[model samples]
Target: MGESGAYRRLPVAERRRQLLVAALDLFSHRPPEQVSIDDIASAAGASRPLVYRYFPGGRQQIYEAALRSAAEQLTACFTEPPAGTPTQRLRNALDRYLAFVADHDAGFSALVRGGCVTETSRTTAIIDEVRRAAAEQVFVHLGVPAPGLMLRMAVRSWIAAVETVSLIWLDEGRQPPADQLRDWLIDHFVAVLTATAAGDPQSSEVLSGFLAAVEGQPRSVR
Candidate 1:
């Protein structure tokens, strides 16, 4: 079959997915503002008009979609089965999270840095939700049904550190290896919670629980 005929035979949903994957791949390499509709079309093996047909709002619309997809994947990084100790679960989660950073270097950097040229209210909310969801996941790992003020602040502070370190890791050429970074971040969490536990009884209890659980697990990844 001819090239255009082959494209025409693709299901609508499948074509849109192809465009999204292509767009995300481009976005993963460069800042979103640097990518163009023509670039996306060529990457997806589709024409500019065909790209527009699926995304009438053009690059901005596709960017938002790609951002949404990235957000979903990023948020999922912290979720794991409740089968391991707190630190063990966190180790698994950080492995996945850092892997995403390694894969989507530019995209992760752009999202963390903020003020993307295509920034819109919707995109901002999506990005914010990623942070919120990540924090919630940490709380879940702590087995906290309702976190107190100090506990919330402590977790959020560590969450912010994770983003900063990830950006720095990219800026520094991903030095120290991902497992090292992941272990360091988990250690920082333990330390932060420990400090918070000094003043906050809730953090005290959760940290105690986490420490007791950590005793039975492998110290770190092999």
Candidate 2:
């Protein structure tokens, strides 16, 4: 279709969606610093002015839209309870996360590694929400207090660990495959939780230290 005809035909919502999707794809391969309005326009099959018409705030707005999309996909599986034990729930969560990453690798990569988000308030809020949700889930699974200080610590550590492992996997082109990594994560969590429940002081202490270290940090998200 001609540019003017295409622009006239696309609804505002459709145009915004297209811009967000294309911007995310571009941001994944490079940081926001390297991305431009023209790149997003070409990628989205829309005119340059059309892209800006939908995203007047430019790159930052596009970055936020990308983040929202990434968050939606990643958090979808955790919205419901699994059909088994706590260990099963954790396994299921891991499976969902890996699948999301695999399917939306570009978006996930942009959000986590491409350095689009910069504002402290926005970044912290996003991280806090993700960490709180994760911690609450783990606490519920373990029959622990959800809002307790320990839960906060646990959540922070969990987020940090997940992000760290995710980056390593992404850099290595996800060596050993997502299924292998998912299984390994499940086994590790089960072992550690079992040890903690069995009153292993070393396990408790190690976990506590890890949690504390993450919680003490100011910015948990990047």
| lDDT, residue 193, candidate 1 | 92
- Model 1: per-residue lDDT, tens digit, 161-183? 99999999999999889999999
Top of the candidates by lDDT = 1
Distance (Å) between predicted and true CA of 171, model 1? 0.4
lDDT of each: 0.89, 0.63
Residue pairs with backbone atoms closer than 3 Å in model 2 (clashes): none
Q: Estimate each model's TM-score.
A: 0.94, 0.74
Q: Cα miss at 8, model 2 (Å)?
A: 1.8
Cα RMSD of predicted structure 1: 3.4
User: Which residues of candidate 1, in runs, are more than 4 Å off?
Assistant: 1-3, 217-222
- Backbone clash numbers for all candidates listed: 0, 0
- What are the root-mean-square deviations of the candidates from the true structure over C-alphas? 3.4, 8.4
Strongest candidate by TM-score = 1
lDDT of 2: 0.63
